[model samples]
Target: DTAFPAVHWVMMGLNPTGSFTPADEAYTMGFEGREAKKEGDMRLLKERAKELGPGGIAKLYMDKLSGTFADGAGGYHSELSLSRDYGILWKYVYGTHRDYILLLTQLFYLASLFMSLYIVINFIKKDISPEAFVIMLFVLGSFFFQMIWEAGTIYSIGIYPYVFALCVLGLNAKKEGEARKEENDDVRKPGFRYGNKSGFFISAAGFIALIAVHLRYPRESVIVSVDQFLFQANDPIALSDGMEIKQSFVSDKDFSIISLKARNFEGQFNDSVYEVSLKDGNGDLIKTNEIYGKDMTDYEFTTMDFENVPGVTDYEISIKKISGENDLIFLYYDTGHTDVYPKGKMTGITGSDTADLTFEVYDKEEPGE
Candidate 1:
């Protein structure tokens, strides 16, 4: 069975010939390279792989499988490991708002755990059906694989059916147990029975409470925007002459603010002047602002606001070091070929033509509209 699946995966290019680390590297390189030359970290990884012999490659593979590679933070599959912390997974699945939703999700996760334990206990007592036992095995196997190897929310999709099956089996077992208890005792339990007055009032009260809370606190409306920061921070573009980075964007609606991620290296204070200018489609300057290096924070978005800018579609933002002796300010960018913002293209970075600066464009929103 393993051999057949292994052969199939290899044929489909799902499984590569090298160890897991190299396989990840190959996949990233192929996916993000996009006909561009592999430079920087990608080139370094390829060289490092060639230097590693068979024994070294095997050790790396074993380390990743055992979840000991960089304390489970080294591989691409380490997303689930990192998200194991409290509220991290919830925030990833759901947006930052809606604390009530996070609490409900946590309750469901707890219920699933109890369901698993119930299935295991019934199986041990030889009271569960064969189908349920198989479903339990599949669920447990998926969990074990996540614990040992790579795990992500995406990987959990494959075992959703088994999980739903286990839930049904657990519910059926609970009802059957209740039925047997009633028959043996020859008496009916009185608490929270369906089709009863007490149950109907309690359920209605709960539903009304939920509705009240929802009406009192509605979810925040999220602004629709184009974000082109896909990959991790690449080599920062140093502020220098002839290195003026410009990002052009088009928006269907009116926009007043454009934010760019930047880093300040000069210890909280510097005497450098960073000029940010907004240019029109025909190379006409509309608005410009000068930001002192002392005011900028490290690895944070610097927002440049345009005043009295009406519904313009095509606009360009330029950032250059007007007065700075040393490289005090650096702009971050994405070297990968995301092409997420097709209406935008970044220019003025050395050694790369297709690279785009990490940026986000926000549409103007009116207050109390």
Candidate 2:
């Protein structure tokens, strides 16, 4: 009776609570800055589209041309485009939505299974053998052809599952003699045969081919950097005077905040007490606060939150290695922090350094998802 907010928000906000179509998602994928967000978006779209029934998706895609999605951390990155960046997006989409789709596909598959079992039970009463039916069940449960395609995200992770389920149902209906086909093991039926044109295997193969063709895009060849870390900044944030956190890329309609990262704290040898300030080249203090730690000598990268206020110019970082490393000063501000929800709570504050930091202005959005 209880549903977690995570799934609820995903269904409501990102997926439009299943209202939007796959065509909309596939089209929206062309937006800038959508490389990461679009994965979750498309997953919701596909599942809903399937529920609505046939050709809705194909018709949607058929009506549109390839455009751009949201602006990424590095700017425009095509969706499902064969480009390197697009590949990263694909990997994410494949991994994230794979399980949900499989469960859905399994649901459909079970429907056919139940029907076949009914037919099989009647055939047995009529003195027909049920060995082939047993064998078919075994094959379906095994890690065979359909399942094999499920492993590598063969077209959106859900692709193989959906088509596979359809194939099973289609082939089952096409089974040569549903009235009494189970009578002989020596000569099975054409529709249920492994290689028959209308059989599940052949049907699945053709479906897979179509999926492959649909997924194909002109791949983009570009250099991938090896300097990626778990979390990072993708925007050159503009900090206001005394504004520790700014709303550069705010996703939440009601929540506004950004996660802060220390550029050098993780790799540094000396752990010390320091204060960071957001300012400009004029040495004026935009936002100034000292970072107090328990293990002054423990050098580790830590992330916290600061509100982004507009009109801020730059930032300043000052530190004292260890509990007493003769106060040292360091400074760095870069671009990025895609995900919503800020990290850490407010520790201490100064004049105008209220616990709740707010941005003075909101950035205007250009047309696109």
The local distance difference test score of each candidate is: 0.56, 0.34
Model 1 pairs whose backbones collide: none
Q: In order, what is each prediction's RMSD in angstroms?
A: 10.8, 19.3
lDDT against true structure, model 2: 0.34
Query: Ten residues in a row with the worst lDDT in model 1?
Result: 1-10
Model 2 alpha-carbon drift over 4 Å, by segment: 1-271, 281-283, 293-305, 313-369
Best-fitting candidate, scored by TM-score:
1
Model 2 C-alpha lDDT per residue in residues 52-138, reported as the tens digit of each score: 445653333322111110111111112232221223444333322233333335444555555555545645666333454554455
TM-score for each predicted model, relative to the true structure: 0.56, 0.23
What lDDT tens digits, residue by residue, belong to model 1 across residues 1-369? Answer: 111222222222212222233234333444343333233334444454566656665554444333321121122232332221124344334333434453444445445556766877888888998899888777777655543333234455566567667877887887797788878986565662553476457656865686687667654432324455443434355777656878887655455567776556574566678788888788889989987777777666677777435666678888888886655445544546544456667777745545566666654444333
Model 1 misplaced stretches (Cα beyond 4 Å): 1-114, 120-169, 175-185, 195-222, 233-236, 326-337, 350-354, 363-367
